[model samples]
Target: MTKFISICALVTSILLLTSGRPVKTYSELYRPQFHFSPEKNWMNDPDGLVYYEGEYHLFYQYNPKGNEWGYMHWGHAVSTDLVHWKNLPIAIYPDNNSTDKVKCTAWSGSAIVDKNNVTGLQEGSYKTLLAFYTSRGCGQRLAYSNDKGRTWKKYAGNPIIPEAPGEETRDPKVFWYKPGNHWVMVLYRMPGGDKAKEGISIYSSTDLAHWTFESHITGYYECPDLFTLPLDGDSAKMKWALLGGDGSYMLGDFDGKHFTPESGKKVLDYGQNFYAAQTWSNAPDGKRIQIAWMRESKYPGMPFTGQMSFPTELSLKSTPDGPRIFRTPVSEISSLYGKKMDKTDKNIIPGLKNYNLLKGIHNECVRITGVFDVKSSNMFGITVRKSRKEAGTEISYDVKKQLLTCIGSQMPLAPVNNKIKLDILVDRASIEIFANNGEKVITDNFTPAEQADDMELWTHGGELMVDSLEVHEIKSIWRE
Candidate 1:
């Protein structure tokens, strides 16, 4: 759903006129170096994420006409390594002759590979790529791509699931259930026009064309995703995760028709911007990789208004509290690593003011990995995107409060074994911090001052031991 327009949207539109096409050279200021963003206009919510035939397809909510939200269409892109992307034509669009009073935009949904020819829609040697999406006020719809997502055709029997009476339903996340030998669709619903009645509705289908209502559970809102993950890397100990649009999730058990809650709600990212995350369907090697919309970020004087977070691999690990989800950037990101620097066994003292560990190295796009032993320091952190004048953003941990703070957002994170490990990815406009080995994640956006590219490590009140620190400058995917 379109929440609110950014104040920067007005300025972005006045800066330049869009060509209504994807541009290869991403030279615009604040453009992400490695993140996936459309060349122009408004984009949000990663939809129809699926991997097939060595290509990963990324479809997102796009506004084609301007740098603001409206005229929703499914913008398409494909990547072999998930780091470099080639933009494609718009996959789906809103129906013009819709009879619904409200606009019929192609909203959020999921895609799957019909390897078994379940729908009998395959026309080539490769399996059919089936995408299920909501036609806004109308209902759930289906479209099929026979040419590996190069082209798409809407199903003849559109709106496979009719609109609900006195309600609105959207964002259908469909997956195959092996044990039950059928398909399960988890959809977000607003029953009786009541926000309090907002939750996820379950449906089952024997064939891809028709669906039957199975059950409804209250609590979740918008972009409901249901998938199974093995806990603690144990394939036999599997659990179902029901993720909501706001990055909150619940661990449970699913029997294809119904879901039984085993754990309460837990956050996936304690950041202000992360939202509407979706996993790749039919991913190879049993990997559950995810991408999310970095909502509410403003990109002034640029053609694009929103960007997607760096793709991450998800895993379920047993924690002291319970089984929680962990997210780390995928291994494929190493393809963009360049110009590395390393340091070990360095001491950070309180008197080391104006000291820069990254004195000679200054780059807008880089990765910082630091493992600091909280020896006797009450506060220790790193400052990135810094300049001689601007102090940049501080990513620090408070020992007494057990809180990790960055850019005014704080995550309650405790150090593991008295050592705080941080893997930070800094781009032109964003910073993604993965702390304590992905136990906590924060995604933040910022516009640095002119020439703000310095970095440093600091300690407060006492001394800190830096076990190891490594900085790797990232090569921009847009450039060669």
Candidate 2:
């Protein structure tokens, strides 16, 4: 029934879309580093995200029959572990009723598990899958699903928020916070600025009703996610961080009513294409785990996709300069090792790009550790699969400005340079990489124009060396 509805909705949309839209599919796009492209279709701007029961429910804008952005429906999937995902029935589709009756587009919004069933939202009630999202041509809408998210129903008092400040105002993330003594909403939108563009809006509500405009934490051009975390060592020392378009920001002492940034604004991951980030709710160990859409560096249009950095443990490190946001790959990547373990103790200058390890092995992984001499080439970069441009997979690590960038057919991100060991996760069309072991990472989901699977390292100029290099098999999150 869900599939039929989704198909019917899309078929009807083809007739309604305002011409000039391009259709795309998984076969047409590629990205490496962090992987989440639909196995056979189109997906973008993850929305209404929820970690329910024991499964991670991820919903995004999808077009069932084509690779275009219109005819939006809430496409969904569930994962026990972040990898290995199972496609669920489509979550939401256009009503196909009257043209004027609730023009639903399922724009960007988020979900929450009403554990207490407040608002008379019963656990077994379909309404339990409470969601807050935008419908594009329409205003903001509230929706619910009683049957564990298999189905949905828009709030009777739909367009619950009436109107947004402007036309581009969307991507709503709601959370239950005590600072203002009630639930607050953080929306990603541009604010009018002179000589500047801002992204991200903050709103407050005493009981999910009567919203009050607050402050603009800062401006960004993409989805903004705000959440509170306990200080590094003292559980009592809590801080709130905002994750979005240009990167992320950490604010000190959130009073629910407002928050002031204690330290400087921080860029969480220096990768070229990391954005539209989401976090795990009620983390398994109680700490926050974050994941992002590792995209190609090109502008909007459905293109091939890439892999994702493994789930990163987001933390804060206090530096004399200020509090530095820290990230590290989840510890489970170690399971990829088998018999192929190559150990080499090679020492060279900290700025050299080409290290001769001509004899490479297959079905293997490499781990390099170096203290980075941090010289002028701080734009220190590392590359893998440089079988001469128009071919193999290539990744670069820029130490100077702190960024992890990858380039390949279909991989498009702003360039990055710098230093450090490159943890390249390569398997088939997937490539997941974590530099600083996860603090900074890049994932590309692309099928190399041609497979030069043999791994080699190179750089533009100067010399950089390997402190230590170890090899192991890369475990596929898809393999059970």
Clashes of 2: 61
Error of 1 at 317 (Å): 0.8
- Window of ten residues with lowest summed lDDT in model 2: 409-418
Which parts of model 1 are misplaced by more than 4 Å?
1-25, 97-102, 353-355
**Candidate 2: global Cα-lDDT?**
0.59
Error of 1 at 84 (Å): 0.4
Question: Candidate 1 lDDT, tens digit per residue, 210-262?
Answer: 99999988999899999989999999999999999998999999999999999
After superposition, candidate 2 runs with Cα above 4 Å error: 1-34, 95-103, 123-127, 164-167, 190-198, 206-210, 297-309, 334-344, 348-355, 363-382, 386-421, 427-433, 442-447, 458-465, 475-480
lDDT for 110 (candidate 2) = 81
Per-residue lDDT, model 1, residue 48, is 99
After TM-score superposition, the amount by which residue 254's alpha carbon in candidate 2 deviates from its true location, in angstroms, is 1.7
**Local distance difference test, each candidate:** 0.89, 0.59
Steric overlap count per candidate: 0, 61
Report the number of the highest-TM-score candidate: 1
